[model samples]
Target: MNFQQRKNKILAQLASRGEVDTRELAMALDTSEITIRRDLNRLSDEGQLYRTHGGAIPVDQPPLPFEFTQKATANQSAKDNICRQAAALINDGDIIFMDCGSTVFRLCQFIKNRKIKVITNSMPVIQALQNTAVSLNIIGGEYDAARQAIHGSMAIEHIARYQAHKAFIGADGLSAKGLFAHSEKEADMALALAHHSHITYLLCDAAKINKPSYLHFAPLETVQTIITDAALGQLSYCKKKGVKVITV
Candidate 1:
């Protein structure tokens, strides 16, 4: 089979299964693993698929918003590792802003014992840190049932009332253009948090890098640092943009 034919087969598999492994595709197509990787890279650059560590997943034109439970399970290990790294950056008596991103929610588990203040709109983060020594400041606004979080003009106003030492956020997609999200409300909240904090850290898994989403919140330069899994391959691009890329 030719290059185009192999790519078409890979796309077909991605469409049916939602994801495809490099080695598995190589075996099935009777091609070398290197060739499969090249095809995946090409397809990913074309925005047809999203390349992962050893595989690729179909790209959603306008990324879908995942529920709290669904996001908690997807890439759980990667999220845990990233959160651990982020948790270490916190100091005692520091005030922090936590966004309602699922990956940011994982940081709550690792930092529940810390003696720091947490201002957030995430119900999950509030629940996770309620019994801990961490001080909780919940942002009040209209509740979003689908996201299980609070967001609106009031939430933005509430966030602006306080400043933080650091703000940790998550995005549906990250590219050279900036951070992207499926919901405009979430984007507005993230922007507010970024503006109110001294430093901003973007917490996301490798799969989200270079993936495009519906709403562009802010540019890569807006955040001080980006914490992600080691599978991300855009370090050069990030470095060129003057954004610190921390791979856990």
Candidate 2:
């Protein structure tokens, strides 16, 4: 097929699957991987798609899906590394407050075997640790089915009733001013968790840095540390605010 034909096929695949990878495109189009990569670069240059490590997603990508699992896949590698660093900071027998953020949800896998106790409103976290060695305190409130978590005034109040050694939370966006959330309920839960914890650790991928959302939850300086896949040149500024930034 001609390059134009291949381009049409690639665009169609992206429209259907939300992303397209060089290897898969090459296989489907019966072309070399290098050729597919070149085509993707051309499309990126034309603002037709946004280039990622090994793939391209729609340039004008719609807002992320509301489901927890879908959101988890956006920056899976970065989230995994960030969670690894966050989990490493936990010591045996420590109490941690974990939020319902997709990034925080990944922390469940790394901490399942730890002797630490977890306080959370995330349904996924409870399901993950229910049979593990970790103790769990589930905050109860209104259920958010889309996110598979609990949120509302009750959930916020429940979190305030307990104190933890550390709080692991996620934010939709982050700026020098503060952490941002898409909704007030989420912001309230994060704020409550941070308030009741001795130390707060923010878990986020590099993309979240300087990204703004609707509701501003906690200030950037409020957190003791931030764990991400890349520092993205924000290390010095975070350090100046007394927030230690850890890059994986």
Candidate 3:
């Protein structure tokens, strides 16, 4: 294919699959992986996609795609509120899985003094809890620098070896349609974490409601609870589906 044609085709593939690796794109396009990497570099420089170590993610995403610093400050108040409730639900000797996000960051804010065994893929979570009393297990693999989170086959493998009494996840968009994430790696980690947990909780804010996005890691049915502010109107549906709703 010509240069323009190839770029157009790659864009379509990304929209459909959410992400594309250089080697996989090279094989599919019948070209050298070096060429695919060049295309990815160009696309990234143009603000068309997020360039990962070996792949790229669509630039337009409902998850806001904030850097870790920006995310930590985005919804501080709501995060604090939701995390308080999450910490309350977590008993003293519980085995907990903390998913990466600003909301969960708040939960980690309080977890330091606790006596819980915590498993997480968030670099910031590990940094925050490094000197704490909570026992820690860090899921390591391909790390996404912008999000400061880890995922991939290796991280998923580590997650499979652990089980948690409850999993507290940070969600981007939530609605009756599905729970959305920005990248396939995040979606995969969320899916794997949900299956390994005894109970799953998604923490989101009012802005995330009804905002449709590309990836749905797990439907509401897969989660045990959704902790959000009161402006979220779909609590009734979420509750009817057996998701323990926590709004405080």
Candidate 4:
């Protein structure tokens, strides 16, 4: 089949199954895996889909709120560094709450070797840690295709049933007004994560510091710690308010 036909088939599979694996697509299209990869790369570059470890998922419709894959690439180095520090805080057998933020998602790779229980609402997180040593408990709720996460009142209710030693979450922005997000649903999830955990850690990059989004979910004092890049280490206001600021 031609590139156009293959692309259509790939997208059709993603729409039907919510994801498309390279090998499966190759087999279905009677093409080489290399060729399928090239097509998936082109489609990813064109924003037609978001590439995962070995597959592609549909991009968010309208694309106003960034897709999970898109956000994952933004300030990637900073996110990885911050996540490294966040991972250090985790101990063996500890139960943690992980939110569906791009930065928090990076934590999956770092903590895979550790023996810990992760309670999360992110499908991507579940996929990343499925084969790892870390135990996972997925928060059941409505799946949001755009965010590649779970949400809704049911998700919040599910989170309330468990308590964690630490909560790792993200925000669209942080300011004197507190943690904010572009979507109210995300803000609510962050709040629920913080509420059910003994200690909450806000994971964000420098760009989000002091920036405020439309919806404010939690106050600055809600989280006990904030992990970010070195550029945003001088958060005197946060320190004065008893919030530990750790920069990497």
Query: What is candidate 3's TM-score against the reference?
Result: 0.71
TM-score of each: 0.72, 0.72, 0.71, 0.74
lDDT of 1 by residue, 1-248 (tens): 89899988999876654557687799999999999999999988889987766676567522223456567658877887999999999999999999888899878767867899999998767766765689999999999978868999999999989999999999999998889999999999999999999999999898898898998878889898999995547756788888898898
Q: 185-233 in candidate 3: lDDT tens per residue? A: 8888888888999999888877777775778767779788888885635
Q: Candidate 4 residues 79-105, lDDT tens each? A: 878998998999998999998888898
Candidate 2 overall lDDT versus native: 0.83
Q: What residue runs in model 1 are displaced by over 4 Å at the alpha carbon?
A: 1-66
Candidate 2 residue-wise lDDT at 148 = 74
- Each model's backbone clash number: 0, 0, 0, 0
lDDT of each: 0.85, 0.83, 0.78, 0.84
Candidate 2 per-residue C-alpha lDDT over 144-179 given as tens digits, one digit per residue, 9 for 90 to 100: 877778999888888878999999999999888889
| Candidate 1, residue 150: lDDT | 95
Clashes of 4: 0
TM-score of 4: 0.74
